[model samples]
Target chain A: MLILHCPHCDRMVDETDLHPGGEAHLKRHGPEADAEAFENYLFMRENPKGVHFERWRHVYGCGKWFLAARNTATLEVYGTYPAQTHQPPQTIRDTITERQPGWAWGDFR
Target chain B: MSEPVSALRGRATSGSVQVSDMGLQGMISLRCDLSFGKLKALSKDLVGAPVPALREAQVRNDRAALWMSPDELLFLMPHTEVDDALSRIAKAMKDQHHLALDVSDARALLRVEGPFAREVIAKLAPVDLHPDVFGPGQVLRTRLGQIAAAFWMTDAQTFQVICFRSVAHYAFDLLEASAKAGPVGHFPRGT
Candidate 1:
């Protein structure tokens, strides 16, 4: 089971108490959200290789929306900080944690 | 709601004040926003910090507990803190928007702790409650033995479950039956 530490609460949670969020949240761009645009928005993916951002919900607890840093190839988790920033930070994409995986992108306790 | 009041959703009576027991060891519920404008400040006052608070959840404070959701928090104060539990909690949210609800009247708590405690709970509760899956400090609002319940894992294989007080006696029957397989835990945490 996945145990996630809420950055806000600092408490560990099992997968049972959480709900999986949708694919990486693509920042919604105003003025470009037409009907056809909305459909494409819902059905598209940019499967990037490096640090990618996704939406996650702490259903059982805070129930607040947050951003999660993860790598698609390794299913590694970089960090799960709050989604306060309107835009995803680009600095993380180049980070490398020196752990078992040689970088900070593996499953965390 | 199509939900049926089972052994978990205990019945409420008119003459005697309604009550709820989780049929577990430690249990307490607090409903308070207390008119506190901001959640972070109110929480910091209740607990030392404002993190990991939710319904049915438990935060370890030696003997006291803290679980705050958007508005309310259900505390499982240790068995020793009952007498003055309310005051401390009140002081925490003294200047904030707080509502201290006397859960003893509407909720019932039942504890099952022993080697086979989990075994008996499995009969009624369907969720996989193994230690690894349901870790400590986790709270769940799930159904128990046909009754909806809020389950909090206080320790390994130890649980504090509570529901509305209306069906307290019915829960007693089910808990008593489960206890046959193992001994009951302690009474409510504090008082």
Candidate 2:
């Protein structure tokens, strides 16, 4: 089973203690947005093989939602951050880029 | 009022583990922003100790507050004193954004004690139960077998596991089965 560090509790918790949320940092499209944009926001996903960002809730532990950046194929978690932010932190992106050369994630390289 | 029946009233001890239903205890599920200075002080006043840190517990006399999550805690005391405890806490936090509910009858508590207690728990829980990791006063909320449960280590050889009243029988059965199976084959190591 995968183990993730919950930023809120500062503990390395098993996957069983967590609930996986879908892709992270998705901008919400409300009534102000066009139909196509709203549909894409709801139905579309990156589904990338590597370097994905996702949301996770430490349901059984801290019960706080957090974001995780990781390589989907290797399951190597780059880092975990609080869920309140609208985007991944720059330090986490830099670390990912350093670890996986030439890797790029949405709005980050 | 009708008397409450224990979940494991007539279970016989098996192997080195002894499981006993703790009967009824006052349980209050409390939720608040612990980071707020005033609320933190109020919690301490209510529980007679500071809010526990992370998975830890703050115990004083016969009362305790187990940290269930960043924003949640479980207050436990003698069953007869639950109502008083609830009212006092409610009055203290009348102006705060908080939720407190008396959950004394909503869950059942089972106590497991013996030299093999850790092993018995290890078989059904994914947590690392090494002495260094989960010693006395540490509490955790996780699934025991297929049912969600919370438990705390009261001493070296004893643990208190709490699950919803609806699943108490299933939890007891699972624990009994694990106890009868003897030592767990593998201890979970950090992944």
Write one digit per residue (lDDT tens) for candidate 1, span A7-89: 54455554555677765556564556787677666766655665456777666555656667766667667667666765445
User: Candidate 1's C-alpha lDDT?
Assistant: 0.53
Q: Per-residue lDDT of A47-92 in model 2, one digit per residue for the tens?
A: 9999999999987666789999999999999999999988889899
Q: Rate the local accuracy (lDDT) of all candidates.
A: 0.53, 0.82
Error of 1 at A42 (Å): 3.8
Native-interface RMSD of candidate 2: 1.5
Error of 2 at A37 (Å): 0.5
Deviating ranges (above 4 Å) for candidate 2:
B6-14, B38-47, B185-191
Predicted candidate 2 versus true structure: per-residue lDDT over B8-41, tens digit per residue: 6545455677887888778899898877667567
Q: Which ten residues in a row have the lowest lDDT in candidate 1 chain B?
A: B11-20
TM (chain A) per model = 0.63, 0.94
True contacts kept of each: 0.10, 0.70
